[model samples]
Target: MRLAILAAYAAVISTATASYAQQSADPSGVWLRDDGNARVRIAPCGSNICATNLWIRDTSKGEEAGDRLVMSLEPKSPDTLAGTAYDAKRDRTYSITVQVSDRSLLTRGCILGGVLCRNVHWQLAR
Candidate 1:
């Protein structure tokens, strides 16, 4: 009976450790733009995932308020994140694809009806 209990405990511990490792492998953190224009903080929202705007370089010119732009990101892979950005000002959706490179994040997508798309390369902020 004691040996059986030990085995059960070991199994539980192993499962818990594996779960923790999987969560840690996900790139869920604050990601900043290399041009110092934007930063996004990603975290889990219920069963889905959400990202919030953490910062922006300028607020005076051509800056849409990012506070209402919280988006849900679907995990395409262990290192890839895909989501749609809802622009509060324009009431439009933009495709967002982010690739994790070490500690940095490479994001590319478009607004303006997808006709004109631009790649925004972002780095991990210290």
Candidate 2:
């Protein structure tokens, strides 16, 4: 019957959605900032992942040696994660996209519905 077919299709869609939600891209490592001024450790932090600052060469702009951005990310692709990042020190949150690679990461964060955005590049620490 037509209704039965539609129901089956809906169930399949639901299952796929759930599966996608659980899948995540891996962005875990020690990374050096693009400017060579900072390094961060990205690893599992509770149920989400976090990028915590390990060191900062220039820490004048309210950036400390231990500030961290806790991220809640879901896989946007095999090598991309998209979600939100919470900066506890600043008490702000940004929508973020992280492109992951074997040796690099390009992270973009936006606020005010993309009115303000910043992209940070990171390389695996040697």
lDDT against the true structure, each candidate:
0.69, 0.92
Question: Over 4 Å off in model 2, which ranges?
Answer: 1-24
Candidate with top lDDT is: 2
Model 2 lDDT tens row, 28-89: 99999999999999999999899999999988887877899999988888789999999999
Error of 2 at 104 (Å): 0.3
lDDT tens string, model 1, 4-82?
9999999999998776556543556878767777787767666645556777778776554355454556666667777
What is the Cα root-mean-square deviation between model 2 and the actual structure?
A: 2.6
TM-score of each: 0.61, 0.83
Q: Which RMSD values do the candidates have, in order?
A: 6.6, 2.6
Q: Model 1 misses residue 76 by how many Å?
A: 3.1
